[model samples]
Target: MSGPCSRVDHMPSENPFDDRLRVRATEILRELTGHPEASFRDGQFDAIAALVNDDKRVLVVQRTGWGKSAVYFVAARLIREGYGAERGPTLIISPLLALMRDQVAAAERAGVHAATINSSNATEWDSVLDSLTGGDLDVLLISPERLTNPKFRTNVLDVLLDPSRAGVGMIVVDEAHCISDWGHDFRPDYRRIGALLDGLPADLPVLATTATANTRVVTDVAAQLGDNTMVVRGALSRDSLRLGVAPTASAEHRIGWLTQHLGDFQGSGIVYALTVSAAEDTTRALSEAGWNVASYTGRTDAEDRARLEQSLKDNDIKALVATSALGMGFDKPDLGFVVHLGAPSSAVAYYQQVGRAGRATDNADVLLLPGTEDANIWEYFATASMPDEDEAQAVLSALSEADAPLSVPALEPLVGVKRSRLELLLKTLQVDGAVDRVQGGFISTGVPWSYDAERYAAVAEARRREADAMLEYEAGHRCRMRFLAETLDDPHAHDCGRCDVCAGQWWESGVDDSSTSGARRILSGIGVPVEPRGQWPSGMATIGVPLKGKIPVDERVSAGRAVARFTDLGPGQVLRSFLADGAQDAPVPKNIADWCITVLKEWEWEERPTVVVGMPNTTRPVTCADLSRGLAQIGRMTDAGPLSYTRDPGSPDVNSAYRVQNLHGAFNVDPATAEAVDGQVVLLVDTEIGSRWAMTLAGRELRKAGARAVLPFALALRG
Candidate 1:
């Protein structure tokens, strides 16, 4: 796995660093850092020289805080200056908007004007392009997804690649590890970079940089960079980071530990959770404990995410409870600590995330509090990135048969894959040359493509191996720092003697009883509001459902309540195990029954339900009926029994159109139940709400059968 370059290794330049280029790059570096004494780190100048002086491709694998960004910022300025008035702006293909914003600011400090085009700043695309063409920009940053945008490809990219024009002076790939499927965070759009490189001039300078990437990922990315690629690899050890793991018995214990020990960590930091619900729940728990914190997850709006990131940087809060959405490209010089509520599936991912701490600080604490449910969460994420062959074929076929390009919404009815998965599949197909994203949407390129079943299987097996490695990490049998360094294939990996096992446990292990009780109180509280479906899914008519646009007011289900979300900390963990796939059905547990009644009592609605009715549950009939009967008896409402399914409603895992079609006319209201619900509000009970299509359809049936309104109540709501 060794590359041409090792720690402190460099390619012999045909000539020593060109004196003029070196002097100019140093000036830019000092300006960027606001430190007149700042100079390039060991191999930073080598990488810049390779690109600017030799016009060669370069790959840099350095640890965090190693000045990988400095290499590019200096190189971009030098290259633009080399070409004089005929110069073209340097092009940077970044992975995240946060990273882009950081890079843009750094570029400005270096006196290099820069701009970005991304989804967030769509209206600014024309102005950015104007700056690029007018030679008013030194660096232009765009995401990999921008390459798939038809307009950008035709107008901006084509012009940038044209040699006859003032094409780009150099190309930079930030977070380059994402280009490889072998990497921990592989993104399909990154595969398009290979094509982009192929279109560029052979002598054009290019540089790819990342803090995370094993030997395999390095080899893959280097190959994608084409021949004669200079590799500048460095030791992957963070001297300022002290690593440790705290084994947790349950969700309550994990929350309890955070509530007690979070305030002890120095300065502001981040607390990572595996899921959005968990992050938000932890934020609430910590805030209730009188800690100043906020939640940052994928569900947070872009504007709020920006605000929260700024708040954390300004030390306005103690911590930000977050998921992986806060993982990459967030820079905080003095971030004091990073704690994970659950272990990530791969050591590579854990290293990348924990790298966010101790960047410029003298020391930072990094700890992992592993839970029993971590494995289940790992399994869910392991397969989420892989492409499904059947879903791929369905999307490709739909595009092939369309007269014109079909938007994702239009193809939803023809293909049964969920929107997120379907979009991922399309990007994979686009990389494989089987499809093209056009003006309206997507179009098949008519390129013959076969499912790479073997490759996908290999990726899945690799995921399992990573998961096993994570389990070993949680065991604490060896030095934690050495384990991560070795896992990333760092040749200098050695026992750091700074970890919990290398030394004695440096922090308190026991969580106080009061903290545990507080965690229990926070976790056990019930009543998650269930926002009902307001409009029928688009293209429902194409599936023969005859439904379109806003649902009728009379037939709409009222906003309701649930005992808890399936991703909640305490009750959610229990519900996850109980409702997991292939689990046998049983009557509602006594504790669950009490929780359901508590949720009902706490729920404040516009109109209270007068009757209880269970949705048809072929899988959990006993549990559904028990819930309906218990709620009716406890709340003094009439029990109307369970509704009957006219036929099997089929699988609910498909897309909206297909899922709605499967349940459109599937439920029936019996004469006795219909009469009993006359002019009355009904409480519809179910074991869980996934797509919520079943509840919507059933509510419509009840409304037609003399019910004035329907309120959905469930044990859990699946994200």
Candidate 2:
């Protein structure tokens, strides 16, 4: 006690373990029959001893299978010797009762005075509390749930306030990321820990640790610990892991793949599916295929879960088929692989699950089998059972009244819905952009609090827009990966040189590389526009007229020039005509022509209103005939046909011959007609202007007779 504490100026440079403490620790380790020569592992011992010398706590976070438990065990042995009988007891806060029990049992084997306080230890709990209050316990492990109880809080405060006690020396918060809302395995009680720390003495050394802290979660944990806490980050990159993605059509294929792979690997692994049912099914299938597999889900009992986890650790099972619930607290060093049977809704979940593998060493593999129906399932989950305006308002009001995080169990009755249904509603609300889930609960995103009902309605309408957009993209003849990358705003190159898209294995035998290149060029040329232009007979109607010398044709001119005339306006109102370029003194409405030109300048001519002019052959009305031929020629040269042609080809003088073929072929019966044709099946299609127009015209006629599929004319032609 007098060695480092007395020398104020020398504190910084003095050896963490002075001669006396070192002698004491060596004597204690000898008595306990520990590795007497195990002196500290150079740098590791130096770090721990230095922390002890400064009275500053150190947090050592080891992955589940990375020998985390050893950090504490070794530290305890070292501290027992260094401090002798004067050292304060260490407080270890364990999140789970089973974990605490395991730790206490392990300590007892090493002759350490480690005791656990929980509901199960009724008689011993009281004795342990008394002993801790009297400064008799070396280490105490308790769950956070117990801290919520008033009795436990009072007992802890009483011990901290006792003058005879050494006070709480070092506080170790294990699984510290559970306190952060952004963590995958968040616990509401973890949030209350900040308040608990505030009640303790300011100078109390604190150590927080977790094996799974990503960059975000680590920042959150540091903030929760208040100032003066140093964060030590470990490497996130696992070198031994080989990441791979597989494209599969169904769950059957996933099971087959797992079976084939697991057979070859022969080490322990985990296969994660979407739901509990899927986990069970895949487990059974793998079992039938002669693999020793076990299933784990939220519904599994605590005891059974422990047994299964132990079996996995003991290599009694070759594989574990589980939902996302299994790997949080369990650590297996030799876990060789992690397979995702379905697509994760977010990248965060994927990162967390994949992180579970390769924690012990580098020889791990992460396999992701993204089924074709995965996106459909994700969309279904996102859009399922969203709360209506009234229900959302009710939930918001209830949440506003509560001071603490409320679990779904406690919130359901207040919101007047079944628990399962409420969960689905919450998830849908998250997807629909109404609320954000923090920790285990959710908060409104100010969307439902819109002052204008119309604005709120418009925001709500975005859900339909998103669904429509997804349907259009998924149903289109394109590369799925390209579509996904574009939707997600990822910086995907023309070819990732990976993915099904780059490999030419996407929808319908994959997209043609030449066609894709040409399509991209066309889109690039279309460019971003400023105004909307109405479809016309000839490509887009020319706005500017050739400025020729003024030809004052009062009221009588040639039939060609006098096709139509308006003389009621003021003399200053110029007449408008369509010509490429001429003189500036043209008699045609120059003002009106100028206005048209301005409008065209703002619009995207190549996209919606497609601009087309006469092909030098004849001024016989620049019809779609000339436009289509030119476009078709371009397409043939580029090998990229099937271009989208606008409804109006701009020409009003005469109908284009090409329009007869493309227009009729493009027309499709509307939703009403499709509904009438097959009432049992839902037709998910784009609700564009042309499609709606065709539907309105043919709906009644199609339903009146023997219509079969009522499919799009394009699809029908393909069939």
TM-score of each: 0.76, 0.49
Candidate 1 residue lDDT tens string, 1-719: 12243223543445566687778888999999999999887788888887887788889999888888888888888877872224588899998767888889989999889999876555466778888778788899999999998999887888787778778888999999998888888889998998888877768898999989998899888888887688888898887889999866787888988899997799999999999877877887898799999888765544456778999999999999999989878899899999999999999999999999999987999989888889998887777678888888888888889999998877877897766678888889999999999888899999999999899998898889999998898888899989999999998888988889899688888899998888877667877766677776654554467887788999898987888887677787788778765577887888888888788877777888999999988888887888888889988999999999999898775556667788888999999999989899999999998767889999999999989999998999886
Q: What is the C-alpha RMSD of each candidate to the true structure, in Å?
A: 9.2, 27.0
Tens digit per residue, CA lDDT, model 2, 605-626 = 2222221211111222232233
The 10 consecutive residues of candidate 1 with the worst lDDT sum are 1-10
lDDT of 1: 0.85
| Model 1: number of backbone collisions | 0
